[model samples]
Target: MVKTIITLLMMIILFLGGTLFGIDQASEGIIQTRGYATADVKEAVQPSRDEAGNVEVELLGKDLQQVTFEEKEQEFQEIESSNFTQKLAGSMEKGVSSFYNLMIQSVYQLVQVFF
Candidate 1:
C-alpha cells in the first residue's frame, strides 16, 4: 500500500510539474509574439516633432479609419433585434434536456434488468 501511494504521489507531482512547464512555455511564447507585434506597430506609427515643437504621429501601413457613433449604435440595434442567439440557446437547452432524459431512462432500464 505504501509503495502504491508513493508511486501515485510521484505520478501526481510529475504531472503537475509537466503542466506547469507547458503553461510557462506557452505563456512565454505568447509574450514574445506580443512583443514582436508591439514592435511592429511602433515601427509603423512614426512620431515626429514639427518645427513648432508639436508632436505629430503618422500611420505608415494604412489610412486611419473612423467609426461614427451612429454607425455603432445601428450595429448594436441590429444585433439586439436578430434574436439568433436566443433561438440558438433555446435549441441547445432543449437538446441537452432531451439527452439527459434519454440517459436517465437508459440507466433506469439497465438497473431494472440487472435487479
Candidate 2:
C-alpha cells in the first residue's frame, strides 16, 4: 500500500538523519581532543592603593569588643551549643529570612519595570 511505503520511507529518512548527526558529533568530539600543550600563566598585576584610598565602613552595632578571653570563650560555647532545638530554630529563621528577602526583591523589580 502507499501508506506502508510512505511510512518505510519516513523511517529510513529519520534513521539516516540520526546516523549522520551522531557521526557529525563523534567527528567533532575527536577533532576537539587535545594531544598535548604547555601553558604559561602570567602573574596577576596588583592594583595601586595610592590611586584610590580604601574606605572601610563598619555596621552600626558591630564594634570592637573589650571582653576577656574567658568571657569570649563562654559566649562562643553558648552560641555553638549543638542542641536540636537551636539548630532547627536557626535554620527555619534563615529560610524564612531568605524567602522574605527574595519576595521583597521580586516586588521591587516588578514595580521598577512597571513604573
TM-score top scorer: 1
What would the per-residue lDDT of candidate 2 be over residues 1-115, giving only the tens digit for each residue?
9999999999999999999999999776765674322243222333223324543333333433334689989988877785779789999999999999999999999999999
lDDT by residue for model 1 over 1-115, one digit each (tens)?
Answer: 9999999999999999999999999977987877754444457776677687666666875544445689999999999899898989999999999999999999999999999
How displaced is residue 40 in candidate 1, in Å?
A: 13
RMSD of 1: 9.2
Instruction: Give the CA lDDT, 0 to 100, for residue 84 in model 2.
Output: 74
lDDT of each: 0.84, 0.72
Give residue 21's error in model 1 in angstroms. 0.4
lDDT of 1: 0.84
Tell me each candidate's TM-score. Answer: 0.36, 0.30
